[model samples]
Target: MSAKLTFLGHSGFLIDDGATTLAIDPFLTGNPKATMSAEEVRCQFIALTHGHADHMGDALAIARRNDANVIAAFEICNYFEEKGHGNVNPGNPGGRIDTEFGWVALTQAFHSSSFEGRYMGMPCGVVAHIGDKTIYHLGDTTIFRDLELIGEIYRPDLVLVPIGDRFTMGPELATRAAEMIGAPRAVPIHYDTWAPIEQDPAQFAPQGVEVEVMQPGDTLQLD
Candidate 1:
């Protein structure tokens, strides 16, 4: 089976495998680059990487409207539950949450997680398996050596890397990270949203890999 992966801008994505659809970090409400609104998103599941406003944007709204399951760190799930969304699948770094399509695993990320002065949980990178393809969304983080090991373990066909500076790895380091992961293909994310994180995608070139610079609403087919 093949999956259609749509880039929802600024680290957000929609992955659909025909039977099930997932929204990862669906931050569209305040996204200047987002072409679709929160109400336009349709998914059976919502998987979040952290609790930042941009990353967690419109998750609850979309989930509640669609009655979708929320997947994220344990604290994030608890947070949502407190907000009245009871259907959640919680996991933490080094843990995996099973889903109908496949599974969602959280990996360590060098970043912080919080929302409205509350400690959400450890920030994480998500590895999701849908159909026969695997996707690694490296949330928000600085370049780390473990990415190579992560690549070896999951061997994802595609990887989503953050190239924005100040908050995460810049273009130069992100290129190294993509090379380290050694995925056949990679997509640049979490950049060009704000002036602080502005970047040129052309600066991100990983050897032996195809770098796809996706714009808002761009979709890719993974088989």
Candidate 2:
């Protein structure tokens, strides 16, 4: 089986493996760079890496509308459950949630996780395995050496890197992260969506890795 990954701007992505569709960090509602509306988002599962507003954008509404299973950290899932969304799978760093499509695993991320002053659990990078392909979505975080270990274990086909500075790694650091992960291909995210984090995608260059700078709504086919 094959899968299609569509960039939803920032760190959001829609991965569809023909039968199941999964949404990751879907922050489309108020996202200026988003090409699609929340109502247009259709998925059977939604995975969130953190509780930041931008990262959890429209997840509640989208999950309710689609009756999608929400996969996130323990605190995040509890929050959704309290709001009446019962279909939730909660896991923390070093934990993996099994699903029909395959599985979703959480990895430690060097960042904070909170929304409206409430602690939302640890921020994390998402490693998703679907359609016989693995995708590593490195949620908002600074450069860390453990990325190399993650790459060796999951062997992701594609890696989503954050090059938006201030809150996350800039192009220079992200470039090194790409090298450490050693993924064959990577996509730059978490930038160009706002002024504070604005960055030139071309600046991210990692040796021996192919970087695909995708615009919002751009789709990449993965085998």
TM for every model, in the order presented, reads 0.99, 0.99
lDDT of 1 at 114: 98
Model 2 residue 13 lDDT? 98
True lDDT of residue 24, candidate 1: 98
Q: How many clashes in each structure?
A: 0, 0
CA lDDT, candidate 2, residue 172: 99
Q: Please, what are the lDDT tens digits per residue for candidate 2 over residues 29-117?
A: 89999999999999999999999999999999999999999999999999999999999999999998899999999999999999889
Give residue 15's error in model 2 in angstroms. Answer: 0.2
